[model samples]
Target: MGGLTTAAILSDLGRKVCVLEQHYTAGGFTHSYERAGYEWDVGVHYIGEVGAATRTRKMFDYLSNGQLEWAPMADEYDRFYVGDKVFNAVAGKDEFRNNLIRQFPNETQAIDLYMRLLDRTGDALSAFGMGRGMSKLQRFAMKPWTAWKLRGAFRRITYDVLSDLTDDQDLIATLCGQWGDMGMPPRRSPFMAHAMIARHYLYGGYYPVGGSWRMAETIIPKIQAAGGEVFTYAKVEKILVENGRVAGVEMKDGHRIRCDCIISSAGVDNTFSHLLPEDVAIKSGYRQRLTSVTPSMAHLGVYIGLKGTAEELGLPKTNFWIYPGNNYDKAVDAFMDNPDAPFPVVYISFPSAKDPDYENRHPGTATIEIVAPAPYERFEKWREETWGKRGDDYEALKEALGSRLMETLYDKLPHLRGKVDYYEVSTPLSTNWFGGYQRGELYGLEHSQQRLKQDWLRPKTTIPGLWLTGQDVLTAGVTGAMMAGLITTMSMVGARKMGPLLRRIYA
Candidate 1:
């Protein structure tokens, strides 16, 4: 998304662009796959802020040239299964607040404060994002004012900030139940990130009409319309540098694409550690800088195909987030320390239920995706092995893990116990195989307080002509990456050059 969005904007400005995707398909995580007549979207389960004509929506409209459409999920878009208790995140700000108040009548004050903090995050995020792309002198000039406006929200820990509002741990867990969205638990995540995500989905959740791939499908044309092109399987093996500046990229197939300017949406780790020359990376301080941040949590995905339709299977449009208990941080720590311990979080999404055009795409079939965090270390032994050919040991482990996750689904929706026709498990290695994440991290870089504080994680790197964009540059999510692309374009072309483009996108 970040790459595609940036290409569209640059192309519109009459600058020819080319997007090289390492994956066989475009759209990165947004891509969907078909198996046995069933199709499922990988990363984009549900998106927020696109149901209406908000800034986020308008950007999507402009990028897809109004070809992209959204289908609203249930009013109760998110369903939480925390232990035995069930909670619903209803749509609409008032409805969400009222629902929460009803759930915790005694914590009205804390809930109100939480809502206020989410509102305040708007200013904090703007300041923080602006700081990322600004030059040293520009940032220094804006530092004091931005700090005063943000009020340290960007530095504080999410759990610490929320715990101050209430003693009830269950409420805190419920509020941060979507922690997996950012690939970090609240105890370690930045409060600003939490607020951004909370406010993003306050209205409701939306699914792209047709499928998530429609996003790239629609936007790619804009790039092509301006004489730019996106190429899949264009594996860039290294970023060529000469005289301490980017020269071009060397492909794995021994081909070279030489250009003075290079925009890498491949991700920070890959760009610095894998792609850039070892000496250049060290001399540029990126090698040392990487030590401060860690990869986000990797996950195990259980994709199930059912013989019946989503309606027949009674799959709700609302996403299901199941946790062992309200103490999310504790649960996550336990699972991280011991893999056998219950999953810290099990997020279930019925893509077939969310997308209105699913029936037309794959009639008489339903697909369910269950995602749970899994350490990359567990799959480390198979790191050198080929994907889909990792042998019996890998297959056994996957089946065992997939079966456990399947039980969770049957536990919630019992009627569909014997309805599953086929299922497959994707470990962290699968993420690496498909998405090129070295550690198979679902989110590029961790959203921990330390990672979020890194000022170097921006579009303009120290290396001239080598730019960065994607989840690592800003927050994580489809919209977040899209915005990162926007800021990256501004940083590259300057505000004066991008002013008209910005006005048109927002207009």
Candidate 2:
């Protein structure tokens, strides 16, 4: 998403851009795959603010040339299952607040306060992005103003801030039910990160019509229209540096693509540890800075194919986020310490139910995706093995994990227990094999308070002609990565050069 969005925007600005994906297909996480006559999306489950003419929606329209379309999820877009209790997030600001109040009637004041904080966070995030795009001198001049604007919840940990607002632990847990979206529990995540996610889906949720890959399919034409191309199987083996600056990238096929500017959306760890020369990274202080942030938790995904229409199979347009109990942080801790413990969170999405165009593409089939955090250490033994040829032991482990996750699904929707025709399990190693993330980090770098506070996690790099874009540059999620691409372009082209493009997109 970051690479394609950047390519599309820069191409529109009349700059020839080339996006290279190591995988056989484009669209990093947005890419969908076919297996056993069923299609499933890898990452994108649902996005928000695309149902209307919001900035996110406008950017989608501009990038896809208005070819890409969206289908809104049910008004109760997200359903939270905390133990045996049920709660949901409804569409519209008033509806959302009222629904929460309906659930926890006595905590109306806290929910109202939470809504106000979300509003403030919108302004603070804009400032944060602006700060990242600004020059060093520009930032230095606005330090005091920036600090003031970002005060309060933006700087605090999510749990600390929420606890202060209310003593209801269940309310805190319910509010932080979507913590998996950011790959962190409330105790560990920053309030700003939480607010960005909460505000993003405040209005509603939307899915790309057809499939998530349509995003890349539609946007790639814009890049090609401006004399740029997106190439698959074009893996960058190393980033070439000369005299303390980037010159180009060396491909795995021993070919080199020389360019004055190179934007790496592969990730920070990949750029510094694997791509750049060790000496260059050490001298530039990047290697040292990398030590401060840790990789996000890897995850396991179960893709199931059923031989019936979504309605026939009783699939819900509402996403189900199942938790072991209300104490999410403790649940995470227990699972981290003991792998056999209950999963901290299990997120299930019914793609066919949410996408109106699914049945047109696949006449008599429906797909369900289940995602939950998995420690990469469990799969590290098979890291060096081939993708499909991993070994019987590895396959056995996947099967065991898949069966356990399937039980979660059966427990919730028991009617479809025997209806599933096919199912496959993907471990953290699958992420590394497909996405080129060495550690299988789901969200690039973790979104902890320390991680969010790092100034180096921006588009501009100390090395000239080199830039960063992706979830690492901003936060996580499709919109977050897309915004990172926009900010990176703004930093690369300068505000003056971006003025017309900004007007055109927002117009």
- Put down candidate 1 lDDT per residue, 90-170, tens digits, no spaces: 888889999999999999999999988888877888888888888889999999988887785557888899888999888
Model 2, 372: alpha-carbon shift in Å?
0.5
Candidate 1 wrongly placed segments (more than 4 Å): none
lDDT of 2 by residue, 1-507 (tens): 998899899998898998999999999999999989999999999999898899999999998999999999999999999999998899899999999999999999999999999989878998888888788999999989898889988999999999988999888988898898899899988999899889999988999999999999999999999999999989999999998789999999999999878999999999999899999999999999999999999999999999999998989999999998998989999999998899989999999998899999998999999999999999898899999999999999999999999999999999998899999999999899999998898999998989878899989999998999999999889998999999999999899999988999999
TM for candidate 1 is: 0.99
What is candidate 1's CA lDDT for residue 478?
A: 97
Candidate 2 residue-wise lDDT at 152: 82
lDDT of each: 0.91, 0.92
TM-score of each: 0.99, 0.99
Quote the RMSD, in angstroms, for model 2: 0.9
